[model samples]
Target: TLNSDTFTVTKVYSDASSDPQVGVSLACDEGGPPVTVTDSPQTTTGLTADFTVTGWTDATQVVCTATETSVPPGYNSSGTCAAALSPAGGCTITNTLNSGTFTVTKQYSDASTDPQVEVSLACVEGGSPVTVTDSPQTTTGLTANFTVTGWTDATQVTCTATETSVPPGYSSSGTCAAALSPTGACTIVNTLNTGTFTVTKVYSDASSDPQVEVSLDCDESGSPVTVTDSPQTTTGLTADFTVTGWTDATQVTCTATETS
Candidate 1:
């Protein structure tokens, strides 16, 4: 029939008519060019058929998230959105590799004085009981060659207690050397008690011309004491007297009778 030849109304050809569009439109808003995902194979979901880039004239933003190949009903392919201006955001992916390590030595310090005594240490990477310095040893019997207490840590470290003559009751050996060390030599000390002596003279003049005597006195408690010329050595409180002569107190008299 010639009516079937009428430029078939089966598909109308008009630009402004109720007809299906035969071509895409270039009329887009002033927003963005758009993001094109050419490698995605989820084209089965017609909702993901197209994507529009919005709100960024500066640069395109991509959010990273996990997505499904076959999307379920009422669900859209989504990922975490951009929280800040960071690079990680909307519609992107990521993969992390192995990690690394960084190290820095820390100094030991105190609240007030930082680093007092020298704390020298040697150690391995991950081991206990670090190597450190040890203290000095003890000293004995080094005084003036007889008693030793302290010393310097040097060669020939000799000390002295000076007055080496060890008086009685102090020590059998003298005082230590000024520079005392552990390995000092020993010396002998005088064991006998030692002192001084003096001599005095007098007649019967009681307290006036008092006799000079380092000898033994009357007693420990006796006052206005008397002494003998022959000084005597005594042990502690012990006393002894030697009286060979004395002025006779009864021999002198005042005679009032005239003599012929």
Candidate 2:
């Protein structure tokens, strides 16, 4: 008995005339062209010469593709046909006429090195949102790059950056967004956000005991704190306590008592 195998490669042109010439290449788990095929839609066939198929067994499937080496004006050469070749198998490579791109960038503010956290970047295209995490929290400042390539012509993409974890002593710069465009950039900035204040507690005359139990109420009831020492002076705090106690035998007067 004799075996039979047939493989064909076809070219898909952008224009009705198929005025441009294109190069088509094919590769299989076996091997083939490096072959060139010119096509014309004007012709009733609308296809190029078939790639001579050989060395394929009776029931073996050949993996192949047809790619363009050159294309017509206003047409892109990014189209290709990838398929498994079977007996009498044929594939078509179309010329993509139009395309565009979109890019996103993650940037930090010029604030001092107060420690930065990782920022997450999101890109939305084709009605789907994909998120990419930037490098881990930055000690210094840093910038990250993100790009969505090979977009269809005139397609709009949205890019955004948000801090994954807002560091302490700083407030979120908030999420930032870039205007929609084929190839546009989105930038996010983080600024220093904080405030400073001193805490001081005043005590009234309580008891005359040599050691009085002084309590400081800072937050709320049910939660109490005891300050053993009076006149406590810290960088952000200055607590002063006053209590009547035995001063001199002759003069028994209540006065502000302070302990260094």
lDDT of each: 0.24, 0.45
lDDT of 2 by residue, 1-260 (tens): 33334446566655444653545555555444332222311222335635544555533456656565555544566566666656446676666544333233334343445444366556665656533334223434444454433334334556666767655323456677663463455555554432212234344664333333223322112232222343345432243432211222232222233333
lDDT of 2: 0.45
* Segments of candidate 2 deviating more than 4 angstroms: 1-110, 113-117, 129-141, 179-183, 196-260
TM-score of each: 0.16, 0.36
Model 2: lowest-lDDT 10 consecutive positions: 244-253
- lDDT by residue for model 1 over 104-204, one digit each (tens)? 11122111122112111121112222111221111222211122111113223332222322221222333322222233332323332212222333346
In model 1, the worst 10-residue window by lDDT is 2-11
RMSD of each: 35.3, 15.2
